[model samples]
Target: MFLNHGSFGACPAPVFEAYQRFQRELERQPVEFLALERRLPELLDAARERLAAYVGASPANLAFTTNASSALNAVARSLDLGPGDEVLLGDAEYGGMQILWAYVAERTGATLVHRPFAELAPGPRTRVVFCSHVEWTSGRVNDVAALCRLAREAGALSIVDGAHAPGQIDLDLEALGADVYTGNCHKWLCNLRPSAFLYARPEVQDMIEPLVISWDFHAPSFPERHRWQGTINPCAYLTTPAAIDFQAKHDWPTVRRRCHDLLAAAELGLEPLTDDYVQMRGFRLEHPDPPELKRRLYEEHRIEVPVFESAQGWVLRVSVQGYNDEADLEALRVALAAEL
Candidate 1:
């Protein structure tokens, strides 16, 4: 049984097929499909429009990127950080994103502050605040909208890393009001890998530059410049609509509710870290050796779940998707009991 949906999501068969169809079409007519700039732009625009509506943003402000990391990188590099500038970050932020900001601080001589939550008071030198909508380690959901409001009031920009929020929860970018919001379509959205988006408010769009300098370098608009980063396999990006359609056709809200219930039940006895998680939950484990226990669960029981060390001791995260059931959770419970 697969229980690690939070790590890398499993795409449904229909969406996978649609992704393959796009790939085949691209391979059949590489020049005709990808080189015809006018037609390609229209198709991309249509896809972005659908995605923007789904995420509660205007298509003009959204740009597709390989993943949330790439989108965050664009924002991180573009920010005018310098000596004496400070960027506030939540202590529970994802490790990869933390590394990116750390690199920015190292190169630009800016200070990066890590606080336990987003309720910190910004100092005079604080230029921006970085936080996650849904924390990866604890599966905790942060009040990003409030954080953004706090940042704006303090004369700081807000960048929300929403890598786990797309299809897991209903998102309204306008309601969130963050300066820059980046999220993954591949996780809860059940899209193929290398598919995600970045939404920048129109006024703040100019602050971001494309990670790759390409033919669209001189493009008049922000989306135009960043959306067409040097030609690569755009099949995953093109198939995002199909993924969204699949979820809609299957009544995904109901499925998500069922998954959330399963996750809640599975978290019994283990300390609940978050009250806002949907399909995934994180629990504090008493096991001294979580890594060995995780390995043994997979090897001896043919179960797949994630257990890792965290600030709050060992953590065992469970992801319940449409494919999961009570039996899967029971298997995990049995395995954990035996292994631990």
Candidate 2:
């Protein structure tokens, strides 16, 4: 049984079928789908509209990227940072994102400050406050709206990395009030791999330029400039509407509630390090070798989960999804008892 949905989410059968259909259509008429097409824009717009409604953002304010990393790169590279400027971030931020910001800091002479906790009070030199809505490592959910407000009060831009929040929680981008927000559709929205979005408040949209200078470089609108990045397959982006439809048909909210309950129940005996997660729970492990424990669990019990060392301690993270059941949890408990 699979329990690592946080690492890579599994697509529903209907969504996968829809993704295949889009891919087949693209293969049938490559030129029409990619270049010489009159309908491509409409198709993209419709997909974006559906996604925007799902995320509670204006269609004009949202743009599709391959994933959260790409979307974040677009935001990071576009910002005019210089020496003496500070970019505040949390220690719980994704390691890949930390690398991206480090590179940005090196290039622009900006200082990158890492806070031990998610909460931050930006200083005078702080240009941007970057943090995650749902921390990947600890599964801690932060008060993102309040963080954004703090950034605004300090006269700094707020960039929220919401890669883990989309389907796990109800998000209203407008209500959040972050200047820039990036999220992955594949992680929780059940969309195809590499499907994600970036939202910039209308006032700040012009501040973000496309990562790749493409045909839309001269486009008048912000989304138009960033949407079409060269002649790449946009099937994943096109299939998002179908993914949303599939979630609606399956009553994903109830499914999520059930998953949360499962996670809570599973974490009962082994109290998790943090109780802030919706579907994923993280518990401390006294075991010295987390990787070995993970491997043994999979090899011996056919259980799949994530166990790794973090700043907090060695952690074993269990993810509960709609497909998971009590049997899966029981198997994991037995395996962990044997290995750890």
Candidate 3:
């Protein structure tokens, strides 16, 4: 009953085993895997093909990264923004993404503006709005098509963080219409640890630079420039196709809907805290005696639902994934009932 797939995704057993096999193959012949291998690029291309098909994008425009944070950094660090340029973001964005932009603004003197929901009506002055497809901390799904319209009207580029959306929502990246989108395969796709992708429209990809300028920096190919960042574990990226297959094998959409139902039922008081949502139920845990309630639920009951205090009130985030079942939800509810 891992409720916190948002923190670090839980890889399915098959996917984990596949990753181990990749590592084993690498260890079997490091020289072949890294240097002498003739088939590595072809293999990568196949993985990219599968990913592009899943997300509705061209394989050439997508680049694999460790996570959404790193993907956002690559985009943030590359854009040539100076003192006058502005990057509008929402207050509800993940903390890591905000920090990435903060670093860029601090060094380059570009203004990092928070696009207030109050003023979010179709406007014409906002520059490059960075938003999440789904609010991570709060399960509020956004109308991305509408937001894209607003950004286009403002002559702004849109960067969408879709960490919580891949497995939870039905997405067509080409139709989503954001200038750039980043999502985690490890989280929703149930891949091995830290596998994620950044998708940029073909025109946008050239402007975006790789985070780590390795030997591929000067290469002629798009994948070379961004893909070969460092000599870290590439198993996660390599085995993503298997993860996709795993989802397909299980009829992922039905499983996702079932999880959502279970989570909604378990959520006692938590309510939506943000406007863009995909997975997780952000309930208003405004019930009296919140602290003692959560403590007893966790300590005495061994329930593992996430409860935190927010501006709205005490909020409990309930999540259901393939690895979780009704028993897990019932246990959490039982524990909460005891405390509440």
Encode model 1's per-residue lDDT on 1-340: one tens digit a residue. 8999888978999989988988888788888778736457777888898999999998888999999999999999999989999999988888788899999999999999988774655778889999989888888888888888888989898999999999998989988899999999999999999899999999899889999988887888877888778778888888889988999999999999999898887734677777878888888888776788888888889989888876566788888889899999998888776766
Ranking by lDDT: 1, 2, 3
Best by lDDT: 1
Q: Give a tens-digit lDDT track for model 3, residues 36-68.
A: 145566667778888888888878878888888
Candidate 1 segments whose C-alpha is farther than 4 A from its true place: 36-38
Off by over 4 Å in 3: 116-125, 272-278, 287-297, 309-314
Candidate 1, 35: how far from true, in Å? Answer: 1.5
User: What TM-score fits each model?
Assistant: 0.96, 0.96, 0.90
| Model 2: residues with Cα > 4 Å off, grouped in runs | 267-271
Better candidate number, 1 or 3, judged by TM-score: 1
Q: What RMSD, rounded to one decimal, does every model reach? A: 1.4, 1.5, 2.6
Better of 1 and 2 by lDDT: 1
lDDT of 1 at 89: 90
